[model samples]
Target chain A: MQSARADAAARLADMGLPGRRDEYWRWTNPAPFMAEAVPEAGAFRADTPIFADMPKVRLVFTDGVFDAAASDDPRLAGVEIARLADAPQWAGAFYGSLEASGQAPVRRPFAALNTARASDGVMLRVTGRAARPVHISYRQSSDTSEAILHHCVKLEEGAELTLLETGTAAARANLVLEVDVGAGARFHHIRPQGRSHGHRVYSAIFARISAGALFKSFTLSMNGRLTRNEAMIEIVGDNALAHIAGAALGDGADGDFHHDDTVFITHGAEGGESRQVFKKVLRHGATGIFQGKILVQPGAQKTDGYQISQALMLDDLCQFLAKPELEIYADDVKCSHGSTTGAIDETALFYLRSRGVPREEAVSLLVLSFLADAIAEIDDEAIAAEILARLQDWLARHRG
Target chain B: MLEIKNLHVKLQEEEKVILKGVNLHVGAGQVHAIMGPNGSGKSTLSYVLSGREGYEVTAGSATLLGQDLLALDPEERAAAGLFLAFQYPVEIPGVGNMVFLRTALNAQRKARNEPEVSAGEFLKLVREKAKTLKIDAEMLKRPVNVGFSGGEKKRNEILQMAVLEPRMCVLDETDSGLDVDAMKLVADGVNALRDAGRSFLVITHYQRLLDHIAPDVVHIMADGRIIRTGGPDLALEVEKNGYADLLAGVL
Candidate 1:
């Protein structure tokens, strides 16, 4: 194991940061983060936390370090929280195992690097249904700050949890989250990346599900200099279900902003189901990319999988690139994937205008419609509505 | 309430002329029907009046209630009491029908410096108008025009017309995709909204719609020109003898 770690560190050092030549990094060049000196983070004051109204246990992280004095009590009913350095034996077992297992068939050097340098993150274990959600908020304090956070989560049998994450961590951030869902357990994740234009974020989620486990994740990415979010999910037990969805918006004019969503789901057990839905709205020379795939193993009969990635480009200068793939080794499995990129439907726009809707409002309506499908994937209505309001604000400010 | 003089229009992308030297006038409280064969520019005339894009008006003057309709944007024209019922209503998958109607009503009201309608008031108004058109609450709750049948689409358009209550309404082939029952339902909806303060321009390829709507005046349009103007009898004459004889006589 020590030799493997050394090998991984050496490989990451040799590869340095991902470049345009990397297959998955072709559309998004990671050269900005590869510089020897990280850029200064502009000072920002977040108006309010995303789920300020929601009754949740809050954990605050400042400059990649846990801020215990500013957070809720570590003790809560049916839930256990521990800082990575002081986590229990059971929690430490899952800290890096799942993430390491995910680096197969495809190499994510950023994730590997994140594991090597992660300073601090939370370890959460749900023994039973959590009475309230767990909210993690990140706050940056330094201009040239760099944050590496790796979170490990484990849900015992029949346990349920909802995790809400928000805020910008730093000027440059590398995040890895690993989850283990036991039999008959359910896990819900909702993350609204702060609308900060100066941050460069590379994040990944590695999740594994057992029999009859349910896992759903929804991510909303607003404006950022460069953001690449990767998710890898494995349904390892029969009758397990997993769904991953994202909605992103990029409205930068100088061509310095880009957002990418890359996801892979594997069905290794019978009767497993998985779904991936991603939508992006780009304008003013901003770029968006989606690369998603579903794999059904040989014995994974009765596997049901679906994947769709679509983009609504608000102008000709904006670009959207998508690659959807499905691989089935079982004869009785059902799998499908589709990708589409288009402008706002002109006919719909004309209809709205003819009905007395102004051009700007009409465009806003169309943009919301384009994102409705992905937003619907969020399980919590209140959270979904909040995210929707944030998206509307973004649209209003970036209207052409 | 609507007037056009020597209207000449051409496709924006192509050099072909659509409406050439056409003149027509519709009086207040009057229902005028324009009958023509395919490729005769009936739809083009309606589009031009509603301020649709992709058309260049080379020579024309159009007025709605003494306002220069051509100078206004589509939404402005709508706010200025002009409405066009599309032959094919657009389907917006996420915008609710009720939301769309309320937004439109409030938008026009705001443009005219009138107070915006309250949600309760708007709902009551929509329910009342939709009841006349047989549009149920369920249909109103669905996305605009999505999954609606052809008959339902036409009725929705009429419901919109009733809710908007514009001074000048243009119907472009509203009868094309309707059965006898649906056509009568639509006609009834249109008739209920008729008043001395409003006028209508109903464009159709056949005279069937005129029979139900009872136009006060009928005109024969061909080759991008209104060759003949007559009373309601002209519609019946063309309906029976067909445009073949009318074209022959004109030639």
Candidate 2:
């Protein structure tokens, strides 16, 4: 255990902190993260839990530390949970390992920082179909606290699991999640970020899929001061599918809010399908960024890939930046990518208003319609409806 | 029921004037057909009346039941019992047709201090109205006008008019993209909505639609003005001899 911590500390020192010179960090500066000091504990009261209406097994994490007394029993049929502190030897294959492996072709220094600094995390293994979703609710009682969490999930052959995540862990948080789906297994992930404007978050997901496996994830981000979410997915076996989608909204007149989504997907096996859909709604000088890439390796025949990133800017003061790239080495693959940024359609707005819909309600409908494509990516209808409700609430609060 | 006095309109972003001192009136239950050549400001009158953007009503007063139509927002104007069937029905990709209709109906009802219609009641009402317009169940479930045929789009507009049940309706080139059969279907839908408490201003470039709609009066529009007003015979004359003779006589 001591040796592993030493190695992680050494790696952290060697990598240091990312800077503006880094190609990936050019659009998002990491100075705030590097200079932030640990915050003191304070009172925090959340208005409502994101998935309160859904049926699930809940796990609570407070102030970056697991709260066993407040959380439900971590025992369920066909599933095993291990606290990282209890078995340090098992950390080699799950912790920092997957994060390190994802560095190939591109480097993510923040994920490494999480590995070196994370004090506690969850290790989950699914041997059979889970009875219900497993939800992890993060709570923060500090005004300026920081949390670094690492979670690893593994699914056995033919097993299925749904994971739901919500809440803001702290004022500033860094999270790294590694997932491994076995042959014929299916995994679904739905997360709605905390609706607090004081948060600055950096999160990463590293996923690997085997033959005939399916992996789908959708994230909804409503409020934050600054947030950057990075995802790297690799399809390692034939006939596998993976989809990653996100919808974000940022509205403020001060220009202090910014959100970014950077994704890299690789098709390493034949007959693999992958899709990426991201949408952003920015108003009142808010900014949004999207940098996505799809790589089809050599000999990856019959691979299907699609990527689209769009932004609806409510006013001229707001901004949207997108960089979509597709690299296909195979000859017989179908791959496409597109990015667009525009304001609400005046013609559609006028059409709705002429039909007796009020101007404000008409705008809200148009905004939701703009985001409908990305929201439709969620396979679970119940969870999709919950997310839709959250989106509507956010629109109602932030609408002009 | 509807009256216009010296209605002058121009493009908001350009200096080109589209309607110059246009005047017209229609009595209760009367169907007035405005026939003219292309760019004769027939559509402009409808747009200006509906409070569409990009048009500056430099001078005019339009009234429905003696209410000031120009002093209200588009939605407010709609709630005041005015409806405009678009020349080109917009294709909203994500909003369902049923949802749009129900929302519009309830919005108008709510603005008039009436209780909103429940889902069951609204669905039943829409189904009954849609049947008369030949709009099947599938069309009502799909997004508004998305991937719909030209005839289907026109029928959808009439369905909206029927559901809203406005006091004054304007049909702007509704017969432009319809075949003979589709035209008859649309005309039938409009004729079904005619009553003593309602009126219609059917603007078109052809006299064929007036044949099915049976307009009580017809007016010839040229260069943004009403050049001639007569009975339904005027539409026949224009259709038979073309607008060249009338336009030459007006100019």
Candidate 3:
């Protein structure tokens, strides 16, 4: 298994990188960035974040390897957290089972590469509800290295988990995450990937939710050179619900942000509800792309889904493109999708200004209002307040 | 404290002129009404005075106190102590009424270098004023004018004007879309706001509202021009016998 894993990594290295010619990689090319991708072993450097009040359990990753010494979070009682000397024990079963299902075959080359080279990824098997939320942080401190991987998380029936995953890299990195939600279980995944300076960041999340289960994931991407994020959630059981919200901020001259989200609610499932809201703020001539699709299989009765994606362009040079599609076969289901891309309302601005708020302050107020719905969804009041403060700070730093 | 001299304004998109060489002046301690039929340019006059964008002032000069009101932006004019109660107040969603009023008031104060009113003080004032106007306190907590009835929206407009306390106020067709009771309440609110230091230009199409508010002077407008000016009896005359007599006399 160890030799096979190493050989897979060697094959991944020989495959080099994905270019625009590939179907999924067509919009965002990662080849020019792959030439600069330098693999490295997990190591740590001393650094303190401004907000130390964040929950303490974190899985720290330097480059692509897992840091067993730095990440001493005892709360993470999952399958494995330490480094892998060889392929994981369930690797063959995990890959083979998913492929035989014939549901979303590994379409992207990067996903294939991640599965081949990823030996240090975490395997979190949640049997039941955990004590507290798990905070996972993957940091890349090196300037010339890439953090690449494939992560698999499985949750059994009646299990509940909250996972806070943040990816920060100085160079190039590609992080791939796969999650399986069991029946009557709950999974909350928060992916905040932004801090990739001059790096290419590509992340894909594939999830399946079972009966009487709830799976919700919020993606907040603010900083990246070339970023592409895709989240696919499949609802296969009755009375299952999935909620996904994403907020992305684009920065830098050549920075490109791309998001493709596909949520599927399979048949034989009744009373399934899904809601998604995607928002992007484009700045500095950066481009933001969002593609969201909701598919309801035949006989998926009583399915309720709502989707809205809005983009605010700060300047004329900045661009935003969005496509929200809905495919429903169930006649009794209620589904709606709306997409809008425009500048701020001038009338609202004048109304605020006439009331005497300065232009910048008025803009901030309007922007906050634009994000009011998203902020209101935070389940925890204290955490919601904390997130609002962080958002204000982020806005001040980026918008100002 | 408000003056409009030879205000000849035309609609930018068409051949119609709304206000033609109309001269009007209102000193403090006065309530003047311009009563006319539909298409008589009463609403256009208020909009022009408020400096709403897209109105071409072909030949006119409007001033507030001694400042050139036409030279300032709409917000700056608002800061300069000019206010217009719109015929159809624009609804702004997601902005609370109290927040909007306080922000507008404080903005005017800030422009004059005055300190902002504390939230507690503003809330107390709003509550008292709202009670007197028969406006529910819950209405003030909602988004401005959104989901509000016609009468409620008009009452809200008056509420804002009272809260702002502008030196010169223009109410454009405030009585058009109100029930009898709502009309009385709104007029009472306006009457309470009237003071020796403030002036009002009430624009309306009917004499019913004038009977309640009691404007000191009445002007009859026809074809974008003030064709006749008289005492309050002029409003009664037009109300008793529609615009037929007035149009006949003018023609």
Candidate 4:
């Protein structure tokens, strides 16, 4: 475990920190993150925290430190959970493996910095279907706290698990989640992030899927100043599926909102499938960016990959930038990538207004419809409904 | 109880005029048909009445139940008991049919200071109205007009009309793309909503739709103006002789 941390530190030192000149960080400025001291952010106490009523194994993190008294016991059927400081051997072996393997083709410097510095996270080992979801609630209590957290999950063959993460971590947050899906296993992850005032988030997810395994993750982001979310996934086993989707609503009242989604998925085995769907709604000079790629390795025949990123700009002041790429090294593969930046459909708006819906209400409805594709990725009915309600609330609060 | 006196309109993007001195009077419990040639400003009247943007109402006055129709916004017009069944219903993907219907219904009710219906009541009303148009549950569950066939789109329009229950309805060439059976279904849906307090202005190019809905009066329009006004016999004459004769007669 120590050696793995050392190697991650060395990797971070080699890559150094990303600058504006870096090809991957060209669209998103890295100046705020590169500052010697983390920027100060105000602490926000959520009035009604997300997933508060859900039945689950709750883990509470206050200002990047675990709060055992505020959390439910970390015990569930068919699962073993431990903090990173007391990680089991199985988790220690696979902790940095996925994150390291994902570094190739594109360098993720923030993820490396997280792996090298993170000391607060949960390690989960699932050998069978978990009784319920594991909900991680990140509650920030200190206004100037900077959090670096890393989580590793190992799912044994034929096992199943669902992970739900919500709320902001600290004034500034750097989170790395590494997942290993075993053969025939299933993993579902849903995260609703960042309602804190002007908080910045840089998060990454690195996952590997084995034969016949299923891995799906979705994110819903709102009310964040600067957010950069990256995901690197690999399908190393035949006939596996990996899906990742996100929906972000950004309203820069004074031109402070910026959100970016960067993703790379690799297909390394025959009959592998992957999908990346992301949608962002920006208004009032907010900026949205998307950089996604699908790579099919040699001998990875019969791979199916799809990627789409779309932005709905409410006003001419808003900005949207996208770069979609697909590199195929094998024959007999099906892959498609599309990126679109457009304004609201005037025809649709007129149709709604003609049907008696007010302009504001109609715009909100259309915005929700635009995000429906990405939100549809969540299979859980209750969770999806919760996300929809939160989105409606946000739209109502930030009316035009 | 709808009146339009010397209504003139032109495109906002260009200087081309569309409707010139259009005069229409639709009384309560009456169904009037406006039969005209292509570009005769048949659809333009419907759009202008519904307050669609990109139209400059140069000189006109339209009143619905003695209220200024031209003064309100599009949504305000809708809430004031006016509905237009589009010739080409816009496809709105990801907005579920049921949800859209409920939202429109509730919005109108709210605007009119009436209590909004509960979800159960809305669902029941929608299902009952949709069944008449032969719109199955699956179609209602899908997005509004998305992936719908031509007939299905027409039927969806009628379903919306039935659900909203407006006082004055305008059908702008609703029979453009429909087979006989589908047309019958749509016509049946429209007829079921007919009441003494509700009136309709059925716009079409042929007498075929009038055969189903059976308008009380038919007006022949040509060159942005109504050329002739008569009973149902006038529509048959134009359908038989074609709009060229009507256009010639107007000239």
- Scored by lDDT, the top model is 4
Rank by lDDT, descending?
4, 1, 2, 3
- Candidate 2 runs further than 4 Å off: A1-8, A38-48, A87-92
Q: Root-mean-square deviation of each candidate, in angstroms?
A: 2.3, 2.1, 5.0, 1.2
Poorest stretch of ten by lDDT in candidate 3 chain B: B86-95
Error of 4 at A35 (Å): 1.5
lDDT of each: 0.89, 0.88, 0.72, 0.91
| Candidate 1 residue-wise lDDT, A309-335, digit = tens | 998988898888888888889999989
- Residue-level lDDT for A323 in candidate 3: 64
Write one digit per residue (lDDT tens) for candidate 4, span A118-234: 869999999999989998889887777888999999999999999999888988899999999999999999998856557889999999999999999999998788899999999
Query: For residues B87-170, could you state the per-residue lDDT of candidate 2 as single tens digits?
Result: 999988767899888989999999999999999999999999999898999999998999999999999999999999999999
The alpha-carbon lDDT assigned to residue A324 of candidate 3 equals 70
Runs in model 1 deviating more than 4 A are A1-19, A43-49, A73-76
DockQ for all candidate structures vs. native: 0.75, 0.77, 0.30, 0.82
Docking class of 4: high
Taking the tens digit of each residue's C-alpha lDDT, what string does model 2 give over A236-277?
999999999999998866336799999999999999999999
When candidate 4 is compared with the true two-chain complex, its DockQ is 0.82
Fnat of candidate 2, please? 0.71
DockQ, ranked from best to worst = 4, 2, 1, 3
- Count clashing pairs, candidate 2: 0
Backbone clash pairs for candidate 3 read A194-A223
Q: What is the lDDT of residue A21 in candidate 4?
A: 92
